[model samples]
Target: MPPLPSHEYHVGIICALHIEMAAMRAMLDEEHGTFSKKAIHDHNTYFGGQIHNHNVVIACLPAGIDGVVAAGTVAKDMSRTFEQLRFGLLVGTGAGIPNLEAGVDVRLGDVVVSRPSGVYGGVVQYYRGKSKAGGMWEPKGMLNAPPVVLLTALQSLQAEYELEDSRMPSYLAKMLERRPKMRSMGYARPEMDKDVLYLAAYHHVVGRTTCDACEVAQTLARPPRVSTDPQIHYGVIASGDRVVNDAVTRDRLRQDYGALCVEMEAAGLMNDFPCLVIRGICGYADSHKNENWRRYGAATAAAYAKELLLHASIEETSQEKPVQQILGKSSETTRSEQDWAEQFFSKKQVTFQ
Candidate 1:
């Protein structure tokens, strides 16, 4: 069969980092290769393929360009060319807010999904606001939510999880079996001992790249679980332009927004493109953070995203509204109109859920 046209691709997955894209790409059941771009201005490098019954096109932000602004540009360019994106999955690594007393003890390599836990609708941009006084109005990433088809799928998957654990382990194992070299790059789960949570006040020794130089005595103690399998949690995810590398900021965001995870790019996608953010916990949002678990973190989140897609029926996905229509335009919309603020604010019910 011929490769699918960009219009036929119903799902779009955006990753801000290369490891995130690599892990997501490995989850594809069939690699369809890139289709011809309909717009020359859409600079995103597309990796088209199928995930179960859905045609998923995955793209990563261009090299060294990250944060909210870069993410919005990538999503806008992608939507223009693909034309039929029902919704997006922003899969990547994020700084986790570990709150043991809150039952949201997010640990390294685990996955945290965006789901409505309060008024925030799963993902909220804490700094985003209409008023010039940034603190007065939270960024509007709060205004959008994953579409109904995806929410329905999320609910179904959550219900299934109550009966059994997530299928991420099986999926991750399969992905590694297909791409064995990923194991060398740390895609496989690290030893339980390495998954340490340090004290909030304890800063890593300056100029040291890894935790090996840091004192383990300053770390927080917790009993180890019998199984080291990555757990999946659902709740509000805080989205902003800054990285939370200090315990003070991490604790503050959690207290203020009730966010379980923090990341840099979700705010960009949430305001314009409707998407679900899935992040693997690469480190505790603290001074001791390192890249040790990043590869595995990226893989676990990708695995959960793959599992979520399986729950969404292709028929329902097909019936959903195209992204262009949601943005108050059509696939043929001019490039200038595509990125305008008027087009986005014109639709009051952009969430479509």
Candidate 2:
């Protein structure tokens, strides 16, 4: 087909860490096609000439807010060149939230779309009078929140696999057992270490917070906020600058913040980007950071994101009548709002090897 409309195929795919990006490339290879790695950046890897007329731009930036901002900026810039840049998708892995159940672990592999409230710490500014002291809040104005359709796809995949076994590293698991107080707070029993929990949560939160750079004072100074209509889910993501291999810290974050997941990049990215945080439970907060489990979990979540993108692209292309009717009034509207089914079912056929 006439080189699938430029705007229809061009997408920005970003991974926060190297492993994440690698996994993403692997997935793309399976679905779209192989990606040839091009130049590298301080926070991203450029992959050009991919399948389906879609130029797959991949980035495995450093873990933190600075990395997110730098990568996002690059993605945004690269998007400008495309005649049809549909939307941006950040795919990869993350630490899962505790007490969320093994079933939900399927959701971990799904793509979590962050409908950004605004740029905060490093690049964008957060709105004023919108957040409380201990917790983060959404911004006001024309909110062009990023899409979350990606997560839906992952959820579908999770259902398909019916994979229930969740695990972490052995050393990490032992760490959590040492902290009784943390365990009481709902942090899973450690088969590993105690400090990992605290460090992961701390860094995850701090990094996300700092990256958004939600300078309330600065945002308040600006004019009315421009809101875009996009689907998004809001929740807390735990962070720590260090790799959390402890149970105590993990429980502390769950008890204190009711966080949904823990990861190195969210805190960093959240600090700068006003977006919803979704995490796949790779392993319970412990030294038992199971590498295989982590990879599968991350892939599961990322797969979900890909499915969502496919649906979204279809929606955008088809221009479902209801959506058209809703936004028909204003061409100036930056985004169109549509209700996406929260729970998704997988259609992929499974075969026993």
Candidate 3:
């Protein structure tokens, strides 16, 4: 792979699925230019375009692949190609960790922004620990907090939203209008009335796509929210190697770890990349999982990402001397991720285990 043109693209956004990637790509205000470059090591393509005043590049996994390991490989290759990358944004859809019983009523189509509170960082990987047949477990290591710059920007955005209101809904509306394909029922916003919360033990009927087959009498009664607009929750995000479809496990994890959202990719990126994780809540992390609100959830997260970028400045993100310049290397393929591991994480070893 040849070197990218010596232009500074300060931001890199990564998504796990095509829908998530499309949601973000649709929000580029003025795509002044577009280009694709393959990673020298993995051959994964990184798409580049201009969004607002920033040069942004996005990388996504090939179809049908999902998990932390794949995310790490794509992010690694993306870093190699976009040498001027300052920080990355893992923007995508995830499962909500809502326990109406606990007053944490995160519904479908809401957005969750990982923010550090107490000992937990912005994101935590629940699958990192060891398990035994007796239900015994050993805790795994914790991931570092997101870069200070991202945390600062998140605080600013939160304060601004508190004073007024979120612009995510309007941004999503315009995005759907611009990209009409996202206006379909599956991708378009779902009716707030259809958002249901079923009993954890009452699983969805097998081979059914809709919830009509599930016993409506088993639903959990909760006070309706005043706003249907996507509400943003800030706190720890639970990430693991597998999808959380079991409500029993989801609630157990939520009760145990206080996770606001559940996802599959952010854990891997935590090792070498100091970036923020923003996820839209599409499903309830239960047996009744469906694509009904996934597209809308992804759109909301992408819109929030764009809103956050408006507050970011290149000066803070580019404080570190350019790694490419420091190494005096034209292409990053000459150095492996092991080289970066030494620089980023130091003597501490990082692995998917």
* The candidate that achieves the highest TM-score relative to the unseen native structure: 1
Better of 2 and 3 by lDDT: 3
Off by over 4 Å in 2: 1-9, 29-44, 48-56, 62-77, 80-84, 100-145, 148-235, 239-242, 267-279, 315-353
Give the per-residue lDDT digits (tens) of candidate 3, residues 169-250.
7788898788777786466778876888888888888898888788889988878778778888899898766666778777
- Give the poorly placed runs of model 1, Cα more than 4 Å off: 129-141, 328-353
- Candidate 3 global TM-score: 0.86
Q: Over the stretch 131-155, how does candidate 1's per-residue lDDT look in tens digits?
A: 2343332444344777778889999
lDDT of 2 by residue, 60-124 (tens): 56455433335445443344433244444555555544443322221222223333322421111
Top candidate when judged by lDDT against the true structure: 1
Worst 10 residues of 2 by lDDT: 337-346
TM-score of each: 0.88, 0.46, 0.86
CA shift of 154, model 1, Å: 0.5
The residue pairs that clash in candidate 3, if any, are none
What are the clash counts of all predictions, listed in order? 2, 93, 0
